[model samples]
Target: MKRKHQILTIPNLMSLFRLCLIPLIVWLYHKKEMYGLAAFTLVVSGITDVADGIVARRFNMVSNFGKAFDPVADKLTQFAMLVCLAVRFHWILVPMCLILVKEILTGILKMAVIRKTGIVEGADWHGKVTTVLLYITIFLHLAWYEIPDVWSIALTALCTAMMLISFILYGIRNLKLLKNRKY
Candidate 1:
């Protein structure tokens, strides 16, 4: 059994810090009319989210609690930011819906795989790239103060493509792993 202290290590604590920043970001975006600053905050939080995983892995601190909490933290930040943006920008629904569906379905599949295989691969490389692209797209969209011209649209399209492709890749990888399992 894992020790209780391990569950609250520095990397996991950083993940939790990201979670705590979500509400402030949303509030700044909505109430304070500070989309750019909010977007910046989100970008910082995203970096921390990614960093936590690296820290956990580099230090061999991986644990069930961290595994479970990391994805939840990521999805919470994604959902919160997307939902907030969706409320103001209806056009965001397409990508937001795709993200939400992918997250929810994959989450369920991951749990089943864990139950059966007694292991999960965590987030793959494609998944990490997709997340970075999503963040870039979101930042571009939220840069309302001085919206970039054609590049924003291009990045949005690129982000959507990456997201869909990543979803497909993750599904295929996980399905293959599941199929190969003896249990």
Candidate 2:
């Protein structure tokens, strides 16, 4: 598939909007009494994430820039939020670290795929599911402010499992693509 080089599409703009919301979310989250505000900002962030995807698909505005840029924005947002939460909830580190590792390995594989096949692979369903679950798990902690420990542990386990599954699937896909690359 030919890559769309367009950078100014609405979907891309919304992804940029999500990136812009991160520091604000983190700042509000750190404030002693601003959990609600922080949660609201996170909701806004998640909404924009969903909106961008819809706008991209419905309007045919998907772009090479967006395919790569959107996930970066998401990981940044997730990383910042996870760090903020880890200050109070140490268990947050589990998924946070797994995400860091998954992303690093995925990045290396993506570079290999691009070098060998000359294409950037777009995210598939497993990735989408993992992202959605991550957001939901994070948002739950942010929004509830008093989320019980049991719920926290369960959500973290679920999120970590999803990440692991996605990580393995992505590894397989990237390797398969590289193996099948034409000279």
Candidate 3:
């Protein structure tokens, strides 16, 4: 059975499209004063994120490229959103930096593991939960203008804590894999 490694699969396409939306989202948020439209675009990007995963799994269109590209798109979008919001809410930089460091470390670990074991680890529950919480937090900041500043700060801090926990969990899991290596 030949596996499709093509870059133009449905899921890959959707992921690419999601990447494309980031600049538009940023522009809408910053230049156009279109918070509502920017938020809608973000929601659409999230939908595409979920849809791509489901379509890839259901249709057996998963590839190594998809495995890699999907998360890149996700992280890029999340980072962009946080940065954009940080312009308004400076405290958001805390979580933004945390998540960015976590991603960089995890990405390095993933590359090492794949080089040694050829295993590409998928998203764990903790990571998924963190991502969802991040999206919700961003959405709230974008849409709920009535939310108090204190509440927004609290939410971002909570998300940052979760992001740290997820990073630690992933580190533990990957470290164990490395320890078990038969070298």
After the best TM-score superposition of candidate 2, give how far the Cα of residue 72 lies from its true spot, in angstroms: 0.7
Could you report the Cα RMSD, in angstroms, for every candidate shown? 2.6, 2.1, 1.9
- Model 3 regions more than 4 Å off: none
Model 1 segments more than 4 A misplaced: 1-6
lDDT of 2 by residue, 1-183 (tens): 443878888999899999999989987888655888898888899999989989898888889789889999998999888888888889989988999999999989988998888888889899999888888888899889899999988998998899999999999999988998832
lDDT-sorted candidate list, best first:
3, 2, 1
How high is the lDDT of residue 72 in model 1? 80
For model 2, what is the alpha-carbon lDDT of residue 37?
87
- Cα lDDT of model 3 by residue, 26-111, tens digit: 99989997888999999999999999989989998888778889989989999999999998899999999988899999999888
Q: 1-183, model 1: which lDDT tens digit per residue?
A: 554237878788988998999899889988998988998998889889878888888887787778778878877887787778666556567778888899888877777778878875677788878778877777766766455546655666776788899888877776776898732
| Best model per TM-score | 3
In order of TM-score, best first, we have: 3, 2, 1
* Best-fitting candidate, scored by lDDT: 3
Candidate number with the higher TM-score (2 or 3): 3
Clashing pairs in 3: none
Evaluate model 1: give its TM-score.
0.87
Go through the candidates in order and give the clash count of each.
0, 0, 0
